[model samples]
Target: MDDETSSHIDDTDRRTLVNAQGAVQVVRTTSESVDTRLQQLLDRANQQETEMTDVADAVSELSATIEEIAASAEQVENRSQTAAARAEEGDEAARQATERMDNIHGQMSDVRTELQSLLDRIDEIESALSGITRIAEQTNMLALNASIEAARADNSDGFAVVADEIEALAAESQEYADEIDAVLSDLRSAADSTDSELDAALVEVEQSSDEVERALDKLGAVADAIEETATDVTAVSEATDEQARVSQSVMDRCTTAAERATEMTTTVDAIDQFRAEQTAMLEEIDDALTEATPALSVTDIDRIPTGLDPLDEATDGGLLLGGQSVIQHDSPVVDVVATLCASALSAGYAVSVTPPEAMSRQDLSEGLASHGSSLSDALATDRLFVLDMFDEWTSERNIFDMRASSLADVNRETATRRDKPLLIVGNIAGEIALLGEEQARQARYENDSTVFNPADTVCNVVDERTVDESFGAFYAGAADQVLELTGDGPNRELTLRSSPTGSAPPRPLPATSTPVSPRGD
Candidate 1:
């Protein structure tokens, strides 16, 4: 039992041990294989984890880039909105500019239309002015032709009136004449009557001058005879007076009586001689006056031309053609006459005036200048002559005698000098009569050729007191002309009225044509 039992037991134990060892080894091998596989799995899991971390870093970089892109897109959207707003503003401004341009164009069109209308109106005005100018020219031409025809007919009255009208027309034309041809027409009218009037006047004056020459010779003989008789009478008276003185006492008385008788006889003889001489002078003066009468005829007056209508009408188309004597009284009537005479001279009359003391020379000069004449030119023409009567008269007898003598002498002289009219003025009532009535009448009647009555042609110069009323009355009267020169407030008017009958008015005298002031060139 023992050995076999030991061996069997051992075997049994060995078998049990081997089986248990084999089972344990197999379980250990399975666990190690599982641990290696788990390690490999863990290593793979770690690699996966590393891969996951790298992926996460890459994802963060991509997210930051996406955020930057979003910001850029927002900025671009804002810029686009700003651009759209600016474009809308620019379009609105353009529309407003177009509207302003349309308004300006409309204003320009209206201005153009107004300018065209103004041009049309200017053309119409120019046409009207042209028509008026043409009418004025034609009127002037007609006046000129009429004046020329009248002058050729040798009708002085017609010539003077027509010439005056023509001159007025010419003056009117001067304001509008644009050429020399129109001025030539005026000159032709002025020249037409000069030669015809001068020739006729010259012929009449020549005939009268011859008659004056004969009268002068006869008067000279009478004067010499009167002087011789007076000398003889004086000698006889002296002889008788000497004889009376020689005889003394009673004889002296007888001698004185004889001497007185002789002196009386001598006085009577001298008076007779003076009377004869005066008669002879009167006869001579009458002859001279008679010869001068024809030269002063209206025919002579008609041949001359006067350029002024007022002057020609006042003087019956001429000046004092009939060698008439005009008397002027105090009241500036003399001044009126002087103005008339001056106007006559300007119209080509040769005038002579004897001014009284009452006439104002300064007023006369100013009056002439106012009539559109330079004082120097009026004086230099020798057309007007003035005699101061105040300077000529010495005594009362001298005044009467001088007036008579001067009238006779002037009448004779004027007959010789012709070519223009003459005016003689005298202060007839101013002188006192030295001779008796019969003697004075004889002196006046014999010496003077033309006698004028004061009532018929006397012009009273109105004083300040009754100037307005007197002037109105005078103007209404039937005189050849009325001249009213007065200072009325701030105005001065020279009114002239023509006589109802076309005859020259009575002119007192010509005034001295003295220069009032210096002349301008």
Candidate 2:
């Protein structure tokens, strides 16, 4: 379900604040139980890095694709324009052909008119021939009748010869008339056939012109379709570019988010482990305090050794089982005392952190972590408890306020002292809490009251960031052993301001084996 949701969000470009917060909370919750969540964050960061690379590659490919598309669209546009131009030219040609056809039809019409005129002339000729024939027929008939009368009169007159000549002339006129009629009939038939053929040619030319016009229209439509396709391709290219830009933004944001989550995971792991340790110590201490009595013997002293081998040897083997030491820490490095603290714990010392000058909760957790101790582990084992006077927001910090209502409450005496070593470091968050003279004086006074116990080691850290002369002077005066810490890097200078209760100050302390945090600017 979560994977699907994540995919959908990535697809939709939803980066709302609420969702980010929810995701962070989930990561934190996971880290609470195990380091798996941190690993997951790491994996996610790695995946995002890979994804960003892929996106870059994809963007490059998309750019190339877009260029290709643009080229194709341009080509298509050019082709469509060419096609449309040809269509226009074809329309012009078709129009010219139509005009030519019209002109031919008109010419044919004129030819028909000339043919009709010729026909009219033929008709006149035929009419004249008809009149001559009729006249000839009448003359022939008269000549015939005259010849018969002569023959009947039994006279050999020359009139019979005149009548026979008239009859022959009549026969020649009829022959001419018949020839003129035959010529007129043939002319009429030829004129009618030529006119019909001309009409058919005109119809065919007109049909061809119409077909050309239709073809031009279809060509125009095809050209328009190609133009429209080009436009759509161009639009798709632009949209792809926009999508690529959006993808780039998402990758950038994811990279940043992954980096931050990874850092948080690291810090959280440290705190959680340390918190667990402290919890365990706290539970043990609580049980001891409730059931155990305040008592100590010489045997208990051997169990209260500070973790540092040299420091322990210099201080006559180690701290007394119920002794208190004051450390004037010149640097902000938390590990300055880590060796001693862890060493003391190994010797069965239960430690409690109530620092007076931690800048924040991370400051406390980071400090303990540098000393080879997990704050969570200490808390879980009931050997440590943070009085919330520190950063009220440190995750390892118990949310409930640990700030004492009255200065005296801060000075509350150790409830019980058993055979086990009890080491309490007072005021882990006092740097910000005690800035002024009054606050410093009161905090110092409260701490002074709590310095002594039957069988425990009270450790006080005087961070120069907040501890003024009055604060340090009070803690040093109250403490049995005093140590001064100063350094920036690996070569830290440790000096014993005050040694054990007996014997001369031992040889100067050697260099620390464990690394101390680099001094801040």
Candidate 3:
């Protein structure tokens, strides 16, 4: 408006107009700058809101993960608690078992010691019984000799009393011995049963120990798994922590889960230790049982003969002969007669049997063959003599006479021939007894050699069923050595009764030594 005042007045008005226009332009520029700055602030606030939303979403995911981890941690904590309880129970059970085993071992040790003592006592008892038996036998022999002397001196009352006392003592001793033997047998049976029971117990313990060992192995595996899980959980927790620095909420739950897994591993380890200890204890028990099985052999086998050497050692040293032996029979003595006849024939000695009718010749031959002697060799040796009394007798009286005469001839011939051993067998003991004592004594001698009296060689044979006081009297008076051959369990056993050298009264003749044949040679 002012161009120069029209020019001056006009100038003043123009200046005012120009100044107002400048102020207005300055206002418009300031307003535009403020509008641009406000628009920028709004855009930045929007970006900040988006970032806030993303953080919120991330926090939400972290919270969910933390909840899941919390649940897992709780489950792991429960499992660890359960495992801890189980481990405690296992430890308690193992401790109880160990205590029980200790008690069992103590009891077993005491039992073993007691058993050893009992075995020693039994051995002592057995030895005492044997000694008693020997004493009884000696007493019996003494009683028998005393009876003979009393009868000869006509002291009947003394003889009866002495005999009664001796018989009673012998019976008592035998009863005691039998009782001891029975007790020993029972002890042996008990020992065998105990051994069987111990073996079964050992087997059961071994199986239990194996099962416990397997359980321990499984627990160890579980512990290893838990450890691996804990390691993985720790790694996850660390990654979550780094993420939480960028975002914040997930690391805490991962750390808690790792701690729970570690706790579960500790419980498993405790259980494994308990099982391992139990297994070790069972192994020790098994070892102890295995060590205790060899000292029970007292009454299991028979006592072998004392004087005889081993069969292999005695191959060159044959059986010794020349003892007065009697073979008594109920019907006919088959085994004893055959054995003696075979032995004599094999020894290359002239052998004679008085009653050939009593035995089978074929049986004799076969028996000889069984004893390593050929039947042909025995027959060809011309050493076996058979006196057939049946052919020599015409009547019953003659039969008796013939038997008596033949026995006398056999005795006389055997006594006269020192080089030959005689095996005289008779079917009837009555026939031999019928001969007068003087005649019998004479018949028992060959020339000046007496072979059927105590001072020489004597033997008495009487049937067991018919053996009585009279038989005993005859046996006591006539024999130096009397043997009763009896059948017992697939064998023929000989029971010997003899007089001691200085105990009885002196005899009419001096002792005569019979010739003996060497073995194998």
In model 2, the runs with Cα more than 4 Å from the true position are: 1-43, 116-124, 146-165, 202-206, 209-213, 216-521
lDDT of 2: 0.55
Candidate 1 weakest lDDT stretch, 10 residues: 1-10
**Model 3 per-residue lDDT tens digits across residues 1-521:** 11121100112233233323323333333444444554454455445545555556667687667656655665665566566556656655655665565566556656666766776877887788789888888877777877777777765877868877887787787787788788877986786577566556655655665565566666656666665666566566655545545434333444444454455445545554555565455445434433432221212221111111221022112111222334454433444445555655554444545433434445555656655675555434544545444554233211233544556665554445433443344333433445544454344333223442111212234565554433333333323234444453234334333322212221121111211221100
- The global C-alpha lDDT for each of the candidates, from Candidate 1 onward, is 0.42, 0.55, 0.46
lDDT of each residue in 1-521, candidate 2, tens digit only: 11121111111111122223223333333334344554565566556656655665666566566666656666666666676666667666766766776677677677767767876787787788778778878878887898898787765477777777878887787787677777767876776777677577667766765776676677667656766765665576567567656655665665566566566656666765676665465445434433432222233244355655556666666655445566776655455455555665554566655543323445545555655677677666655555556445554432224443443443342233222445666642363363454564455434434443444456777676555553455455444567776664544555567643443343334444444434341
Candidate 2, RMSD to the unseen true structure: 21.3
For residues 186-207, write the lDDT of model 1, one tens digit per residue.
4434333433444454455444
What's each prediction's TM-score? 0.25, 0.40, 0.34
lDDT of 1 at 426: 33
Q: How close is candidate 2 to the true structure, as a TM-score?
A: 0.40
